[model samples]
Target: MTYFKVLFFTLCFLAFTTHAKEQPLKLDKHLSVFQPYLGSWQADFDVAPGTKPVQDVGLWERALNGKAIRTKHSINEGEYGGESMIFYDSKKDSLVFYYFTTAGFYTKGTIKVLSPTQFVAYEEVTGSKEGITKVKSTSDLKDGKLVVSTSYLKKGEWTKPESRIYTRSNQAVKFK
Candidate 1:
């Protein structure tokens, strides 16, 4: 009787494992838009003439079985940094983005695809020290460089935009 019980359990476990392995994985097709950002990138923003440009590094990778893209970024050698999750919402037919920073600020937004390598994310600010009410973040890839611009809306007026250009890095970026 003990031998029979052990054989029965072993067969059940094998059957369950085989069934699980036979299941196929489904990934979102919209996630392909972020394929260009799937590697390491480095950017140096021109702040002023005499001062050195602010340096930032970004690492983007696929997560959640390719249903989402996650970005890990750092500014000025980890002086400040943030991570963001970007996914497509089939129900809304829009791209969704959620960003959280080490500085204790978080923002949610919806993105609109402008081209195969260009997109714009619109966000509403709540507790940001920058005091911006609405934010438009546009990202474009040109000549192997990623160009990103952030435009702020303050009191219903659009302010001067901040932009950055990031180059593809040969080495991979490590995320903590």
Candidate 2:
């Protein structure tokens, strides 16, 4: 009788583990707009004209049992880095994200999906002493490349937008 009981328990454990392994990821349907960006990408661009180009590497992946999307990026081989986690907020009925940087600042933002290939983000900066209080960015994926443009609000004035184009890459994001 003891042997039979042990066998039954083992079979139950096996069944449970198998079910767990086969469970599907629960990503929110709203996140489908970001599907094309779910890989590593690299971009080289000057922060300002006439300056040396900085190399930025970024990686995007699903997180928190697919409830959120996590993005990690580094500039100039880890001279600067940041991580962002984006998830759907049921109360707000929108997708929101929090970004934390190595520079002792962070931003909270909302994303609006305009189309299958385009989205925009508006962020409120906190803990920045450089007088930057707001930021807006738009990303569009086209022809296997991603184009991102950003504008910064500094000291109550909005700056001109700058754009960058990124291509799929195999480089890993690193932090110093």
Judging by TM-score against the true structure, name the best candidate.
Answer: 2
Clashing pairs in 1: none
Q: Model 2, stretches more than 4 Å misplaced?
A: 1-26, 47-51
> Each candidate's lDDT (Cα)?
0.83, 0.92
In model 1, the runs with Cα more than 4 Å from the true position are 1-27, 170-176
Q: Model 2, residue 8: displacement in angstroms?
A: 30
Q: Residue 99 error for model 2, in Å?
A: 0.3
Query: The CA-based lDDT of model 1 is what?
Result: 0.83
Clashes of 2: 0
Worst 10 residues of 1 by lDDT: 167-176
